[model samples]
Target chain A: MSNAAFVIIAIFTLAAALAAATLRKLMHAALSFAVALVGLAALFFLLGAEFVGLALVFIYIGAVAVLIVFTILLTRRDVGKDRGFNWAGVLIALAVFCGLTWSILKTQSLSIVAPHIRALTVKRIGEALMTGYVWPLQCVGLLLTAALIGALILVMEEKR
Target chain B: MTPTLQAFVLVSGALFSIGLLAALSRRHAIFILIGIELMLAAANLNFIAFWHFAPQPHQPTGVMFAIFSIAISAAEAAIGLAMVIAVYRHYHTTNVDQLDQLKG
Candidate 1:
């Protein structure tokens, strides 16, 4: 049952990703990207990373995707018409896909025994963050604060 | 019923390639930023998959790494979109193909 679900979700993810890449309308592409991100969250859940999966939904879908939509709204006037199919881009994507698939299939690391599956709890993650990974966590918080300030400064109109 | 590591890796690679194409070929600046987000998600997926399938999964290294990646990407998107807005304010267009004033 879970395997079937995984396959279905993975297919949905790839399809949404393709749409996000190829869609002509910027708004449609952003929506498609949201779908892809949601599918990725589902995939993360299937991989036993429940916290990461939920965070993906909350952060990417809830916050970042909404931010993209807001930005689009703020700058919607100059969206140009679709310029038709990009054959060169498709070719490049296909070549890169081929190379990556070949490399992954040939790698020997795939032969390792499967690790035991264990779902990580939020408490454990919080504990780890506050203890073992505090420095990086602090840095990320600082980066976010700085980014927020910089964005505000960039968007604010200058006083006359 | 679990998917193999190879399957996960292949899917990520495919997603990454799609993202690369979007980043490279899209004329809109926002589209390029969306492509970058896809690429970052793919890399995070790889980290999570490898961590899940590793023999010694006691440590939450991959989870930690993915979390940090998410944080960093969020910051990147904020600053990048701010730049996009600034550019549009000045040049009045978001099409990257036409915003080539920096080209030497």
Candidate 2:
């Protein structure tokens, strides 16, 4: 049952990601990227990490996608006219994919099925964050603050 | 029966390569940023998949890592896009190849 679901979501995600990667139009590519991210979040849900899935949707789709779109809007002087499609990149990506797929297939120890999934509740995640991951959490908070300030400063107007 | 870990890994690998394709093939700076986001997402997927398939009675470290990775990616996207916009403002063009001020 879940196998079919995984196959479906995987295909959807890969197709959208392909579109996002190769699409000539910036807006279309960004929208396709958002779709791909949602599909990935669904895959996360299938993996029984509902909290993480929700967070993915929230952060990626909600925040990042909007940011990309706005940036596209703000910098609209050259849209749908990007030239120079580098073929070397495609070749390199294909080579990397082939190598990774081959290695994944050859790994004998990874043939085991997923163990019984314990429902990792948001409460448990919160507890884990508060108890064990407190230091890292604080660091992330500081990092986010720095990023926010940095972004603001980067886009701020220059003094004459 | 649940799907094997190999399947999930394979999917994420494909995603990662596609991201590489985006980052490499596109001429626009924003597209490169998009590609980077895709790559980071692929890594996050791998982390969650490994956490899901690990042995019983394990810590939820994988999930935590994924969550943190997501946060960091968000920050990266904001900063990267802001830089892109700033560059666009200064240069009036966002095409990476045309920016040759530092190119020797």
Candidate 3:
């Protein structure tokens, strides 16, 4: 059942990503991106990373995507017509895809040691972060605070 | 390749590539921001996959990193969107091609 759910979520994620990339209307593309993010969160849950999955939904779907949509609405009301597909752009994208596939395939043999699945719970993570990775975690918190202040400054400057 | 892991990686790669295509093809500033978000999501997917498959002492590293990445992404979106708004105010349009003043 879990495997089936994974497959469904993966399919939804891919479809939404394609729609986000190819959609003519910007607003539609943004909405599709939200759907893709939700699918990704679901995939995380299937992988047994429930906290990360919830964070994905809360941060990306709840905040980031909505912020983008709000900004779009504020900045522009109409999405212009499709300007026709650019063949050169498509070719470049295809080239990038092939190159990345080749690189990934080449690295398939290399492996890293991963932790046991049972140790990946949210409680374990919190303990590890606070005990072993405390300094780094604190740094990140400071960084985020700075970023928030910077964002506020930027927004206020825009109004002036 | 194990079927589940293979599927996960493939989907992640496809999403990342689609995002790259959108970033490259779109001249709109906001669209580029969306593309960047897509790429970050792809990276998060990889982290979760590795967390599930690989053998270590800290299984939650991937999850922790995903959380950090998401937070960083939020900050990026805020700063990037604000910049777009500022640029739009000055130039009156969000088209990248039109902002060639610094090209010289």
Candidate 4:
């Protein structure tokens, strides 16, 4: 049953991602991207990383996707007609897909080898964040702060 | 075929490739940005998969990396979008092919 659920989520995610990439309308692509992110979050939940999954939902669905949509809204550009896919590009993409697929299949076994699902609860993650991985956590915090300031400057520059 | 980690990885690879193709082929800078995001997501999926399958009792490294990647991606998107906007304002078009000022 869990496997079935995983399959469903994976299918949804792949489909949504393709749609997001291929869709002609910018608004439609953004919507598809949201759907893909939701599917990814569901997959994360099934993988037993509940905190990571929920964080994906919160950060992606709530923040990132919204920001993209806001940018689209601000631009007010026409969502032009579908520019037909270039054959050369399609062929290149196909080659890449085939190469990657072959490499992954050859190097690793696909079987579910490890079943030891550790608790990825929010509290556990919080503890880990502060204790063992404190330095990296602090680095991430500083990075985000810098990014926030940078974004502010960029947006402010646009207004002037 | 039964769904395996390989299957998931293959799908991710496909998505990433598609994103790369889109980024390379598209003239629109915003679409290229979107394609880059797709590739980033593909990398994130790989991390989560490794964390799930690794034989360690405690391997939160993948998750940690994903978190940092997400933050960096957000920052990248912001900066890239800002550049796109500025370029659009100057050239009045988002098409990359149209910008030929460096040809001199």
Tens digit per residue, CA lDDT, model 4, A1-160: 2668867888899888888877778788888988998988887776677777777788877877887787776665633633645568767877888999889889756756556565666776778778988988778788778877876676564444
| Ten-residue region with minimum lDDT total, candidate 4 chain B | B1-10
By DockQ thresholds, what CAPRI class is model 3?
A: medium
TM-score of chain A of 4: 0.87
Residue A123, candidate 1: how far off, in angstroms? 1.4
Q: Tell me, by DockQ, which candidate is best.
A: 2
Model 4, which residues run further than 4 Å from truth?
A81-86, A157-160, B1-3
Q: Which digits, one per residue and each the tens of the lDDT, describe model 1 over residues A36-67? A: 99999999988888899988898899888999
Can you give the TM-score per candidate against the true fold? 0.95, 0.98, 0.88, 0.89
Tens digits of per-residue lDDT for model 3, A33-96: 9999889888887777888889889888898998888888767833473354556766787787
Q: What TM value does model 1 have?
A: 0.95
B58-103 per-residue lDDT for model 1 (tens digits) = 7899999999999899899999999899888888888877788889
* Full candidate order by TM-score, most accurate first: 2, 1, 4, 3
Give the interface RMSD values of the models in order: 1.8, 1.1, 3.2, 2.5
Residue A85 shift from truth in candidate 4, angstroms:
4.5
Deviation (Å) of B48 in candidate 2 = 0.6
Lowest lDDT sum, 10 consecutive residues, model 3 chain A, at A108-117
Clashes of 3: 5
